[model samples]
Target chain A: MHALATLIALSLASPAAPLDWHPDLSSAEAAAEESGRAMLIVFR
Target chain B: MVRPTTLLSLVASRFECVRVTDMAGVDLDRHRFDFDLTSCILLQRADGHRYHTFGGRTWEGAESHLSVPALVRVLVRTLEEHEKAELPPRGRSGPGRTVEALPPLARRIEAGRRPACIHCHSVHDWQVEAAKEAKRWRPQDGWVFPDPREFGFSVDPIEQERVVSVEARVEGLQVGDRILAIEGTPVLTFGDIVLALDRSGDGPSVRMRLLPVSGGPSASPVERVVSTSRGWREPDPLLYSWRAMKWNLDPSPGFGGPQLTARELGGLGLAPGTFAFRVQYLVDGGARAETGRSAARAGLRVGDVVLSLDGRSDFRSVDHVHAWFRLTRRAGETVILEVLREGERRRIDLPVVGLGR
Candidate 1:
């Protein structure tokens, strides 16, 4: 019970990683092929 | 370097986000957009219909051109446009000219195998280097792009589809007029106009359209011509950095270092206000070792303090001196540099050569 509470507390404290960024264009396109989502590329 | 704001994070979650660090990942065939950018956010359909693009800055500040509201608007607009799913006509994305390995610097990078990757902003410098290598470097080439603001207008990135800021006392543009095209080419977004203006060569005449700001039925366009003047474009430091880097490494006269302090100046028998660069590198990088050794051969050793170039002590910094050399003098020009070498003052006439000579 205590461990469950600790996990819940930690989850609340930690920010969720927002986006799953694909390493490269090919991987992103593959994911897009599966999900029907558009590719959003941010070039730095 | 990219810290996601809360707003960006929210929008990012809804899309298939791909982060590219270098230029090679970009599609030269489909993603034809501005290559001279430091940061570009591109959203497109999976089958290569580009929805929108944002980025193009003055290149001097840490601030991005994007605001949260602006990005939100772009994202909303992108989603709306994505619903259409209509493939844009071929070659309409601009960059119609032949795209090849450009600028001598890019070739130099590929040959040296240093830095491993090319960033888009560096293309500006590479172009200038290529021009120098070809012995066609000139002052007119220094201003590589003309900002649209030179025509008494600034764009609102948020309302890219609708808004334009007309400068005070501008005669032609009206508050109700929305920019529809440039040089007779239809531009859908601000990014399109940016690419058109960037690609437009020296002193080119451009035709533009002004449509009614209000959408739909009651709209007819009025046309205007912009004769780009020779004095219109302003010289930017981003392009000038190429000369700075080349000279910092090249032999004969190219080198990089810092300005000498007043006390250091006085010790060298120079004035308190003397502008001398205390040489930090003759050729420090493996990529530049071949070219940097020329300065050493020309008696500009690593410790040498250079006082003046072309017999003038008015240079601002090492970069300034290099920019002055490139802007004022052409390739193959002779420049007399005065340096304090090994506690002895001497004059050396450096016969400037372009890259890879």
Candidate 2:
């Protein structure tokens, strides 16, 4: 539990990792996040 | 029409029977002779009308006439003068004196300066030979014309396609993910995952193994797994390496890179001014066989904001990130990650696994 808590704390404090992932967002969400246009992420 | 007097003056200026004239009102017809002869002349009427003619048989009428034989003699003389013109004037031989140092008259006539005919009654063959020589020596490549709109940049966004690979967090997936129970089935290297998803039948889910990110004893064990319908999305066109290797200034041919804006970042659930991160999570079953290694297994999840890599502060593009991984890390190596999760920054240690193949 301490390790988990420490890990969570460290992640929040630094919030920078080489291996972090982002959830695939909806087109609407992507549009809201970016300007001009949204990125198309298709899984095949 | 060329005045007889003007034509005679032209003939006196040099030794040529036919002289080219300026036409005022109409086009003149012309023809060639069997002995490889060509001609051009301008004709004008008393009424201010004029005609220009070219490429015809030698003039035969009383109008400026020179027999072929007499024309050759004058041509020779003109060629001699041309040869004299080529040398420095001080070194030229006296008039009528043949100089061995100078080029032959025939060669000069072939060089293209002497006129074909005289303006007056004199028939000058020198000019005609010169013109023929000039016509024969055209450059090989031909003339190059310039394009009017040579510097325009136009883009057609509809034709864009890019190949990209996504490394995601999969807790239940491990190495040796089978295709219909075939062990050692290569997935990542061949890019079969995308193909499988693209050609999958009307099924609710697909199964695959995920390797552990860390090679520690606590890593998770590989297990058979199924992704629920809510967990899957239609695969986009595959981003091939050949296409994704470079970015086109014009978006017409391939997919354009993400142009992130402040607003867009916020909409993707990222904080304004915060850098975005893409993470990969590995799930491994083999590690479970070894005690304590199973706990080290981890996978990247959505919504994680990455801040740095190997202590580097800058956040590069996704492609740069992949290159960094391929260059610096090896399979089974542990990586320290700092991410923003649940509105808080957290640090996690994950192990690297062999890229799915």
Return the top candidate by DockQ.
1
Instruction: Show the colliding residue pairs in model 1.
Output: B247-B254, B247-B255, B248-B255, B251-B294, B251-B295, B252-B294, B252-B295
- How badly does each model clash, as a count of residue pairs? 7, 87
Q: Rate the local accuracy (lDDT) of all candidates.
A: 0.59, 0.29
Docking class of 1: acceptable
Candidate 2 residue lDDT tens string, B294-347? 223343344455555556545445444443443345556666666666667677
Go through the candidates in order and give each one's DockQ.
0.28, 0.01
Q: Which stretches of candidate 2 lie over 4 Å from their true place?
A: A1-44, B1-261, B264-274, B278-296, B355-357
Please write out the lDDT profile of model 2 over residues A1-44, one tens digit for every residue. 12322232223223222211124222222332332111111111
lDDT of 1 by residue, B67-170 (tens): 55556567766766666665433322333222235545446556875456767655545655666678776546545433466545667655664545766635
Error of 2 at B312 (Å): 2.5
**What would the per-residue lDDT of candidate 1 be over residues A1-44, giving only the tens digit for each residue?**
12322232222223553467788877776677667677777766
DockQ for candidate 2: 0.01
Q: How does chain A of every candidate compare to the true chain A by TM-score?
A: 0.58, 0.29
| Candidate 2, CAPRI quality class derived from DockQ | incorrect
Poorest stretch of ten by lDDT in candidate 1 chain A: A4-13
Output the worst ten-in-a-row residue range by lDDT, candidate 2 chain B.
B146-155
Q: What is the DockQ of candidate 1?
A: 0.28
